[model samples]
Target: MVARSLLALCLAAVAAAHGDHGEQKIIAGPLQSLWYNRLPGDGGTQADSVFSGISTFGRLPYLPCLSHKDITYDIAFIGAPFDTGTSYRPGARFGPSGIRQGSRRLNLYGGYNVPLETNPFNSWATVIDCGDIPVTSYDNTYALHQIEEGHYSILSRSPATDADKKGPSLQGKTLPRVITLGGDHTITLPLLRSINRAYGPVTVIHFDSHLDTWRPKVFGGSPSEVASVNHGTYFYHAAQEGLLRNDSNIHAGIRTTLSGPSDYENDGYCGFEIVEAREIDTIGTDGIIKKIRDRVGTENPVYLSLDIDTLDPAFAPATGTPETGGWSTRELRTILRGLDGINLVAADIVEVAPAYDTNAELTTMAAADALYEIMSIMVKKGPLSGLEVEAGDDL
Candidate 1:
């Protein structure tokens, strides 16, 4: 056995040295006796191994649309690639594709292993990539409505059958917990609209560099010239729609230059408490976690929206509104890891503009890493065996 093993190892090394060429897949010649598979990008095809057919957010199946009756999912991954509302940078429109491309190299099975013990995909539930919504351009009103309609269509058929009222609160539940890849932060507004229709008001856990509650930051006439519907003011509208539980809603990692004195007061009026970017250092990671947990509480359903700019420009410089000083990716990951067992109904990771990313795609990769962490948190939400049971009913 020892001699045979040695011989096999020698043959494997020789085959590896030969390099992959043409349409060859198997280890040819002297290496023919062994079976060594490669990853998707390991010189073979787009479809290979466990990583085959990978999609954004992770190696999830890409469904043409989420409304497919044959397949029911516990999680849905969708993209919103419209970025006309971006105030500074215009390329967030490509964020979805960039984030997706950046995730191609990552292992989807327990991709977030450092923070958790298990791969959510391995034991928890099922997930599907619902593809991207073809958001309308130019017409901000139609664009938002299109986004809202797309989200609503998915929520209308989603499994979250129950609604929660207070902290650590959960009503009844189904799956298809939505995870959106963004065109920009404005996507959150329409997304909240969909969530409100299905699950009612939820606690919004916002991670971003800006407060995003400025009502007069519109592009027209003056601050309040046109409707306050840009990427900068979605939370204000969400508040007006009563889609959020204002007091329970919280913002983390804010480092933006506030427009005026009332910015803080305005955010408070919108029903949100602010956690400045520097607070991460002042409060420490654990302290920040404690504050977030304490503020959001455990009763109500929660919706988490992460803007990649929450990280400092040094780590994530591709966002429209990059902040000079902010939390490190490690700190953010630690904070997210600590948020286990929260009744998280849905989440989104937005503003990864690859156009301005490093050659290594540090910004997009950071966003991907965050998405994986969120998946780990979802794993802690108890075994989703019920989702499987529910999905089986149709068969």
Candidate 2:
């Protein structure tokens, strides 16, 4: 009874907090207007220009893209939409669409002092939701190769159209800004490989219940085992390939399980620096931010990967793996917000399997909220410079 009462109180508090806008009006101008009431059909031509720049996923305005062509996208929200890599359950491929559906209801004008929705910072930026990358196969390996090849092709600037020559050319034009929606964690392998080629090494902010560094051999097969490369061993392969600088570069959250100690020792794994959700509660969000900053440095390019299971089952239950002790939505938001100054290059929100969620609430909300946080950060950081979307003027 006490627990139920506490939950009720917490819900009430959140509602009150969200509703306490006081006199803050819902200004609806161009979706870009700073003033609260600039509705979409306002008379200003600039408003239409701004609206056209913004991309929509389902109903919510996703990343804004300036153009689309030559496979160029400043912020491509590609949906992997396949979870075959998962060892425990299958269904994360549904994540992208679910998230897009949920995002439709989100208000573009964030209230209060939220930095992402503010003007000046957001005015010059171009973010876009390029929709899902087309994948014809359900087979994990085939799908991964397709994803890798597709990104490689899109990023390459070489004039060669032949498959043989195109391979090397595509490698040359890889953009630095991309946000992939996952079929599962394993998909990150190809995505990271693409990013590594473009930006070199990067630090990863991994939020999940497991370290995800276990080798496929530990699970009784070689790394080539499709199941091994699935959600469980992506980081392991990344580390082996020298993508991560060290274990310190990978900061994990809410880890309560391990493949074993031998795996940690053999590779000089530093282990998760931060463990236990309660520790976050005690040290406070700012403290966690400081820890991340200290490790990755303020200027190092960082990638954030959020596994929905990182949130407590109560808040995000539609995941292949659900862990009890984890972060709440508010806590996760605080953490992302605190990392504002860091050089976040690319990010992904994964492992949201909506089929398991009858209400479609868990994966949907988590995915949209995660993207919102990432977009918030990007808007504050300024235009990704050379990585603009490639679309005809008609878009």
Candidate 3:
């Protein structure tokens, strides 16, 4: 009887506590306004360009080349939706769609934390969703050509007539830049070709688990066969083609088990520096940042190629060749923030294979978030030009 009475008293106390703190529910209409009205029901009709998925990057106006009579933008967001190059997993071909879907709330559309320093989506940066390049998965050589040509088409477009950094894209400078939504890391080589046309041979800041500098295999009298070309060997081709500066090129967060000593020896021969994934824990993100900045410096234009597998499988499980241990998402964000002031010419975030993703679309969501940071770097215009974040002192 004494125990029963005590239990009853405890239940009564819990009920009382709940009653004391219980709050009234907020009405939906007012709630939407406070959050930029970017919720599903808050959207305008699909036909409404203002509210359409193709028109905005996250509730920000999308402004595709077809939407306006003056179809020019400062930055072109292009998608290379071909995953045929993937060696292990086969779903990165869906990277663009997955990334764009996850990008729904990223802009002012109830997105979390808009940078007070600069808004890349606003009038200051004319960003266009150039849509995906149609690559026939069967033809690897043609697909690569299509990818390169797609970038060229966008790059060749005159920048918004007025690229006023202070105003809207219609008024900003014609600094035509392209950000590729990758099907795989191989997409970077094609993208590098286009960027090099715009800004000479660039210093590449490669973020991945593998060196990606493997030599190409010649097949059936032609090296151009799709089978001969793969996601792993593009960096090697890039160096030989003079598309990327060999000496200053660097690879970060790599933790893959190399096939042989010659593998790393080849990477070194290709003029690439590797920052092992374990080093993130040892040198810390700050140390990694200093090393990257030191390597790229201020002279050479930089191209950043990020393979999602560089992140630990725990944080990014949906990549093609996921390694066991790698950098966490937080570490990547911090490192990217540190690179704010570096001269960024072009970039891509690849290897997001959603087949292995969580039900919550975690991998796709991470890809979107990583793309957001990459866009933020572009908005800042150059290294040290963005969000004035202080460097962490830990190594």
Candidate 4:
């Protein structure tokens, strides 16, 4: 038996070598004689046959428009390819394409035994990749309006009973979770608006280098006024509009500088917990997780907004805004992984501009990987399962 096994292993190795070269190599060993199997690539087909018919790595199904019937998927991935709102960089509008290309090599199944396909209920949940949202050219107002419309369309038809035909109104169905791939951080404004209209109030997990609370920075009457609607001050608008409740609903990560204190503390503004790089370094990932849970609560609906600049510039330099010191990628991953109990309702990865990247690959990859980490959590924990309450439960 041992000799037969050794002969089989040797024949398999030889077959692999021949297949790599697009050639056919037959073996006439005793093992082959007993099995009577055909030689590798003996059918005159291309040697790439082994990989044919399989889905491309990370290439998810694309459904651009959302109808009432298509809300069964647990998560919908949408891309926002606009970046005119960037404060420091000008090319983030290309973020979605770059991230898609970068993520081409990642498999849907977990890599290295990670089991990413498993869901919170121990059953696989449907995750669909909706294509990028169409953005108007060089107009932040138009772009914001477009994204808002798109999100509302999805939310309106989110809970469909039939997978083939459009179902009745979602008067009693759950909404589909929306995961956006952003052109820049500014896109979050409209997204937040849509969520606020639907869910009332939700916690925001913001990862960035700057506080992004400059209200007047781009408010002047100039061509740049539209630019004010960009990424640097999105959170300011969200808080000012009462989307983010001023008490413990917002958590800022890796903050190195404040855009301005008054911007954060003005009357009627929502309160937020800013976790500076110094504090994160001191308390570590475990402590940060505890703090986040304490503030957002384990069951509250949460939105995760990750800007690639939250990582140290050394590791993620492809962003339009790169800070000198910030959290490491591994540390950020650990923090995200630890949030398994938090109900992640919606999420986005923004500010990835490939033009600023020397490698043209790292920034989008970082964003895509961060997105994957979030998706893995959603799959494992189910969409806000632990956070949602029964209809009769007390608030």
Error in Å for residue 6 of model 3: 72
lDDT for each residue of candidate 2 in 1-395, tens digit (9 for 90 to 100): 22223333544564567563322232342233222222334523222332332334523223212223433233456676767778777778788877776665454443223544543213334334556666644577788877776554443322111222211112323243567777688877887786666555567878777667776787536646666776777887787776664545645465556666775554346333544466786788777777877777665556788888878888888888888888888788778777776666678888888887757476577667767777667556654332232222110
**How close is every model to the real structure, measured as TM-score?**
0.79, 0.73, 0.77, 0.76
- What local lDDT does model 3 show for residue 214? 80
Model 1 lDDT, residue 276, Cα: 80
In model 4, the clashing pairs are 85-230, 120-380, 246-270, 246-271, 299-387
Task: Give per-residue CA lDDT, model 1, range 115-210, as digits (tens).
Answer: 577565444455556788878777777888888888767655534222221112122345457788888888999999887776677789999988
lDDT, model 4: 0.64
Off by over 4 Å in 2: 1-68, 71-73, 108-122, 136-138, 153-176, 220-224, 266-275, 358-360, 385-395
Ranking by TM-score: 1, 3, 4, 2
Best by TM-score: 1
Worst window of 10 by summed lDDT in candidate 4: 27-36
Report the C-alpha displacement of residue 80, candidate 1, in angstroms.
0.5
Q: Which stretches of candidate 3 lie over 4 Å from their true place?
A: 1-56, 63-70, 108-116, 161-174, 217-225, 382-395
Q: lDDT of model 4 at residue 35?
A: 21
lDDT of 3 by residue, 1-395 (tens): 22223333544564566664422221212111112222244443222233343422443333334323345655667778888887888999988877777676675343333542555655355565767777888888888888888887776555653433321112221346678887987788788787666555778999998888886652122256455568888887788888876678789998877667788888887788889989977889999999898888754457888898888888889999899888888888778877876767567889988878988877777777777777777766632123121222110
Every candidate's lDDT:
0.71, 0.60, 0.68, 0.64
Off by over 4 Å in 1: 1-55, 108-112, 158-173, 217-227, 383-395
